[model samples]
Target: MPIQNPLKKGSRDPYVTIAQQQLIALGYGLPRFGADGELGDETLFAYGTFLVSQGLRAPTDERPKSITPAGTAALDKAFAALAQGGSTANIIDERHNHPHSGRSVSMPYRPWPKITAVVLHQTATKIGEKPASWHGVPIHFGITRAGKIIQLYDLTEVCNHANGLNRPSVGIEIDGWYAGIEGRPETLWQPKNLSTPRQPMNFPTAQAEAAMTIVQWIVNAVAANGGRVTHIHPHRQSSKDRQSDPGSLIWQTVGLWAQNTLGLSDGGAAFTVGNGRTIPEAWDARYTGNRY
Candidate 1:
């Protein structure tokens, strides 16, 4: 049957359908016309309510804004390819585990034990950059801007965080760019070429949401593995003085989702600006006495 005129005006695409389904899964039960591609007012209202429940204000307008971090994350989850029915979902280092690698995450070089924590980074590199780096970066899985889950690593153990991927912790490098301190709240704009000065890389709302959903899955994985999940640190967090792949905005937004949606503890800290390290600053001897 053709999508009705009313629903067709702003019909929910496949990604939005996934979002609608996820919202229903989370008990929102937005009015979906049996997955027929028609999103009704009831569905919109339900989504708005879900937002409010997560401590975000309801969307003032009928049409929701996709650019917001929360909105983007939801869209991502809605479209994610779920884990094998009963099996756990994890992203392992494909470099070591790929059938072509001969050895796998199962034996010899597991990227674990030594892995102290999970590092989240964004591939600031352009979408067209060929031969994307798969070095010490442990990002095993990533959600695409279109809400697709791209598996770059397996959760077998770990491979290499440095030389040979680490075993225990996994890395997730999202395809996005920081909007920079001065240009945040604005979408990233692509640069013309290598010769052009570095500019903010913009990620679609659907993609940003996908990144957050991946974080939610990671938190669950950490709990199941018995690894004390401390910091969902961005690449910049590890090298404060030097690197900053995932700018502060992505970190904070994703961290909040981990804390709020999945109900994961933000490690017992109030709120730190950069990494969102949950361990209260007071507890850390390194903290000189900063409140936030």
Candidate 2:
């Protein structure tokens, strides 16, 4: 059962009211009639589930219904596990984040606010890339080589990563150079932070784990937001040969997680909205049809 808005307190909205109900039926009660889609007692049941999944004791905290950042990670961990057709984990791995962030707003897709897809990208620039935007990181979330998932801002706010296609998408940037072997069009340009023995520039275990968890959370959030985006694409696919980010390892790793585990549409496919693909075509051409 996916954790909808009412699944946690102070959340935005709840789409799968039954997700909460299932928790309650399964002894993870948030509150009866939790489908009301508002934060209330039922949130505690979900929170407790989060704690239990994290391998922690039941909450004795003053406001047990309250969800800390850690609590959200636990919940996301559980969701990711279940989404992939696996049982809930006894614990969710930890995720790192940036301290500052911008305001969040739902994609409210042009025709209507909705979840069209989860778009992926690479920093292209350093993690702390120069010529920074006053708005914050262009990508909604970033995964560091150390497995840190930095939340630059709420998913609701738009960033520069996806270019014109930002309206119906949720963009994520993973650390390290996602550009392929030949690299980007810029001949002089090169990845500033390539890891050791790096050929594919793979994601570290911690980052990979956190990414899997977060992608699940993002998918659910999109479902809650009206279900417009269901697939995952590379950043380059969203632009006119202008960008090529979120390299193969990310596609193979996170894309497989979305498809095999979550049973989502092919993240490597060239899903077009207007002129852009949901992601890049380069890596997708190779990784598509093959399990990562």
Candidate 3:
């Protein structure tokens, strides 16, 4: 004999209403008709049996709570908002609705992953200055000279690079030439407030600041989605064995900001290398997949 649990009063939806009667008829204890919010324990038991009869196991308890009518309406509204590129986080002031780019770039793909880390790279070229395109060019999210962040590829997708592709990461390209440390003498450029390292050329403070803001945006976005800021990494750190883009200075700067400002532990990495390859130790959190 199943224990009776009655539905609350005045409920009426065809499926629920029918389900209620079915439970009552099936020798399950339940509320009498005309007083109800939804089917109770006995009804749910009967529903489970109904489903099992159809060759399916009962829906697991681990599933998200069943959608109520009100919840369903709210979800529809949320999807609408997301489609408009609305800002979903409450703490962040910035609301990006598709950043503007002067160069001809691809559309923003929306398969936004957990956004573990922000990998920064100097574009190594000016805006609209095309790089030689063979097949399998790496894609990037670009922040132009004017400080606009635009999507270079859809989310969770990969572009060609010297290293891994499509494993798990997003790349961002800032417009600038990456004059390696060896090229500093000819470029005659240096970073302000610090003795420039062995290589230096055209350290754009404005661009750096903008890049920080974007990183903050990404961090906030991840946090809002139940992730943490500790996962952020620059491109150089990811492929330390053979690559460098956002050079050491920018990496130190952004990483320190993440630690000091965001208060993240800086543990866990996001990049991994194998097949006789190696990713830098700093990027361990981003690639291996860390949970917030």
Candidate 4:
């Protein structure tokens, strides 16, 4: 039997047990209280976190007290995808929901075997969770501030995100402004010769976890399609202007973590393409060069 709609706290339905099993399988832990069929705080927190990961709810929003039809549907879809050996990562596929205005018309289709890296980037501003918020943005994937992964293009489309590496890498734009160095203030260009000063926002834990999940998803996806992703790069490695594109905090949290945990590389210390800047020593002591 399917999970009854509006399953709320204090309900004692057997379906609650089913829901608990599914949540555990989906990687949401009810560690303190295992799937005991009691819709308590632990279960509710996991459910709310799952909703936030799927972009269905904002991090700042209150935890949902009841499971609605939409929530059940999302859970079913995600669980089904996971059963099929697909990614359990919360990704909203909007590849066809928006126009391909962000992709260059002159670029040829890239074969899956050609993909070798996942380039990380920061939007330098906040983007809404909806697909419409990513209109005309040239990135394959965008993770919203709410920790939603929105797929804007097919991996083979070769959107012009990372220069030079564009043909061999898939780009992910992490939402929010992150400074090159944590605790340092940054700014964005404004109209005329003006710039707007802003404080660096800390990369939320939810967003960081989503980044890791997506990178692993990309690796698995590429491998299934006859390719291998051997590297994870910061956008700075491919563009001088993007020296702080993802910044130190992001590089340490995501890029370095990927390299260490996922066995991915940053193309080594002296590695850089075009007129791009190398990963600074501050970001990773592996790079002995002066901070750019």
Candidate 5:
């Protein structure tokens, strides 16, 4: 079925179906819904994310929006990018296990004795820039704004992501800074802090979906390797005295989604709106001191 009406929420249009098919093929597919073609939250989020990955502005509203001609052009670009062997998921080649040269964490993470938790982090710097000069690429994986997942390190070892919990946690960094970082006038991972009313962060629909894929991948990896993740923690949740990297609202959304939908463990919430379990600042310590 061709797009009969502008693709909006709750429509059963076949064009919505076609768009969903294309999005999934480009690696922006919905995990749970799987191109059922209903134009639901997962499908729209993926569609919006794909548009954003092309650097096109996509509205954050849940109401359905019509796809423009330029949207088609971007999809063409995405397919071309994929044709060249581009992928959103990867793992470091096992042979280069000795911490290959680009950057290092405060201290090398010991191989995970057992992965009991998944700790999420943000680069806290612009995408494509090295975050290591400060925090050290400390994450096991890094997801880019365009939705590609790069394996920074072979996650068998722990990196200094969480100050004290490295041994039992696996850290994954999604590219981009959190909202409210005073230095960044823009390019925040989200436009609104999911947990608080701070400066807008503007997380792309694509990046959010990319993050969920990475987290689920980690969970599956742990389960396969004779370990099972018991909790999912964000950088802010584990950062007792450290910089709050992954921020609040995004992580909360991810953690809850994983638990309620995917059956992953929800150790507990890191922070809540006005609850104040969070460190008072969003700046990474590597960039500033006592951000609080």
Candidate 6:
């Protein structure tokens, strides 16, 4: 059913739920409140953001009070494109411009063994959206704050991002500094000597959605190449020093959501690949350890 026009805040129409679901599917996260059929603040904010993303609205404009006809059409078009694998249109391939240093001198690019997982990370500082900003970065994908997905390396090449999981996993670097645990003071794991003071940043809905889309893209690409991506991990799971690599908010919004929605796994609560720490209990309640 098409979303009813003028679906403003406080509206509890079924169409409102439909819009919410579409927004969530596109990566405008309603973390606090889900698609509950109520056009509340969270949903409205997500809707406005979506409108802004599609150039239907301006950033300086106030959050849209009602879902206009144009917004509804734009939402439907985007959703249809996503269903038809149009999400790849959002990716900017910079692999040719910025290649990774291959794993060995003998072979410039080592073929990936069998990609089974994706490790997520945060830059711990702002990273620009241009290809020049990601030069020499080891990660396969880098998502900027504005939700641009930049491919820095080919999936077939074994680029070193995670310690032990490089060969079997792909890496996604979400651009921003986020706290390991939200609302907590940053002590260790805080980037040092920055020209400006570092503050905790929230994962924008678009960036989070880009991360989700890329994860699905990886799963599809790997399957096409005779491999299956079965797990989604945080960089912290592969390096003890990266206790806050991507942080809890991101894990809950993107990682845990992937496991629940996309049928992916996090290697269980106690599962840790290398000499790194476990996915902290704060990130996932299944892990009964306090090691964060």
Q: What is the C-alpha lDDT of each candidate?
A: 0.46, 0.51, 0.42, 0.77, 0.56, 0.76
Worst 10 residues of 2 by lDDT: 87-96
Model 4 ranges off by over 4 Å: 1-86, 186-196
TM agreement with the true structure for every prediction: 0.48, 0.50, 0.42, 0.68, 0.51, 0.70
- Candidate 3 structure quality by residue, lDDT tens digits, 253-280: 4444455445543333533443212233
Best by lDDT: 4
The best candidate in terms of TM-score: 6
- Shift in Å, residue 280, candidate 4: 0.3
Candidate 6 per-residue lDDT, tens place, 1-292, comes to 3454677779876567557766887888889976566888888889999998998777855678888777877876675455345336378888888546734233335443467889998888777777688877888899998889898878877777888777778889988878897666473256568686667876666787788788878877787777788999898888888888888777776786577556789888677877878888767656776568
How do the candidates rank by lDDT, highest first?
4, 6, 5, 2, 1, 3
lDDT of 2: 0.51
lDDT of 5 by residue, 46-87 (tens): 777877766687655553366555665566455434323322
Candidate 2 wrongly placed segments (more than 4 Å): 1-113, 128-135, 179-200, 225-228, 266-270, 273-292
Root-mean-square deviation of every model: 12.0, 15.9, 21.7, 12.9, 12.4, 7.9
TM-score of 1: 0.48
Q: After TM-score superposition, what is the CA distance of residue 63 in candidate 2 from its true location, in Å?
A: 52
**Per-residue accuracy of model 4 over 109-169 as CA lDDT, tens digit each:** 7889998999999998778777788967898999887778888899888888989788889
lDDT per residue for candidate 2 within 257-292, as digits (tens), equals 576456667543435544654443334433345321
**Which residue window of length 10 is worst by lDDT in model 6?**
102-111
Cα miss at 215, model 3 (Å)? 0.8
Count of clashes in candidate 2: 21
Q: What's the lDDT of the predicted structure labeled candidate 6?
A: 0.76
TM-score of 4: 0.68
Off by over 4 Å in 6: 1-89, 102-113, 193-197
| Candidate 5 least-lDDT 10 residues | 281-290
